[model samples]
Target: MKIPPHRYPSPLGRCQPEIMDVETTKRDGWQEQHILVVSGDDSRLDFVEREFIRRLGNRLYGGKRHE
Candidate 1:
C-alpha cells in the first residue's frame, strides 16, 4: 500500500508531510516496541522517555558520530 506524499496526513500541522517510524526489538525473549516521530513539532511520553534514558545509562545515544 502506498500513500502519496501529498496525501500524507499529519494531525499536528498545516498539511505538511511528516515521517514516522515504528521500531521493534527483541531481547531476553521479550519483544519491545517504540515509535519515533519526526515532525517539525509534536507530542511525547515524558515518563517513558526518562525511563528509556535511565535504562540506557542516561545516555541519549550510544553510538559514535561524525561531527
Candidate 2:
C-alpha cells in the first residue's frame, strides 16, 4: 500500500501572488553568465542580495576584486 503525503501549514503563511511574479532574462555566450532576475519588494531583493553575497563573497565578482 502507498502512503499519502502529509502537508504542514507554513508559519510564514501563503505567498502573495502579485508580489511573486518573477521574470528572467537570458544571455548568450560563455562570458555572459546566466543571471537571476528578482522582482519584488525591496526587502525581498535585499534578502536575495545579502544571501548571494554571503554565499558567493568575493567570488561574486570573479574573485579578482580581492586579488
Candidate 3:
C-alpha cells in the first residue's frame, strides 16, 4: 500500500513545543539562568542532589565559570 503526497500531511505544519525543546537541547547543551521544568512521578533524587550542591556552592563562592 502506498500513500499519495496529497494524502500525507506535511511536518512543517505541526507545532510541538516539547519536541522542539528536546531537539534544541540536544543541539545545544544546557545553559545557566534557564529554568528547568521536569514532569512525571519518576524519581529525580540524583538530579535534585546535584542541583542543590551546585546552587549551594554558587551561593557560598559566587558564580564561578567552569570551562
Candidate 4:
C-alpha cells in the first residue's frame, strides 16, 4: 500500500512526488497521538490523511476495552 514517490501526482496535475517519513511520540502516557509526514501533491493528500486517521481510530477505539 505504500506508493512510490515517482508515482505520486503533482500539485499541477503531473507527478511531482517526494518522500514521506512518519514518527510518533507518546505524551503523558495516557493519551494516544500520531504524526504523519507527506511529501507529495496536496490533491489526494487530504483524503488519504482522513482515511488513515479513520482506520487508526477504528483500530484503537472501536472495540471494547476489555474485549
* Top candidate when judged by lDDT against the true structure: 3
lDDT of each: 0.47, 0.51, 0.58, 0.52
lDDT of 3: 0.58
How many clashing residue pairs are found in candidate 4? Answer: 1
| 2 or 3, greater by lDDT | 3
- Where does candidate 1 clash, by residue pair? none
TM-score of each model, in listed order: 0.19, 0.19, 0.29, 0.27
Worst lDDT 10-window in candidate 3: 33-42
RMSD of each: 13.7, 14.6, 11.3, 17.4
What TM-score, to 2 decimals, does candidate 2 have? 0.19
**Candidate with the larger TM-score of 2 and 4:** 4
User: In candidate 4, residue 16 scores what lDDT?
Assistant: 52
lDDT tens digits by residue: candidate 3, 1-67: 9885675766966765544566466335435446453332326557776677667766966786879
Candidates 1 and 3 compared: the better one by TM-score is 3
Candidate 4: regions farther than 4 A off: 1-45, 63-67
lDDT of 4 by residue, 1-67 (tens): 9886676655786565554432222232224434444333445568777677667766866933674
What are the per-residue Cα lDDT tens digits for candidate 2 across 1-67?
9998998988667663445323322223223775543323336457777667655744654544443
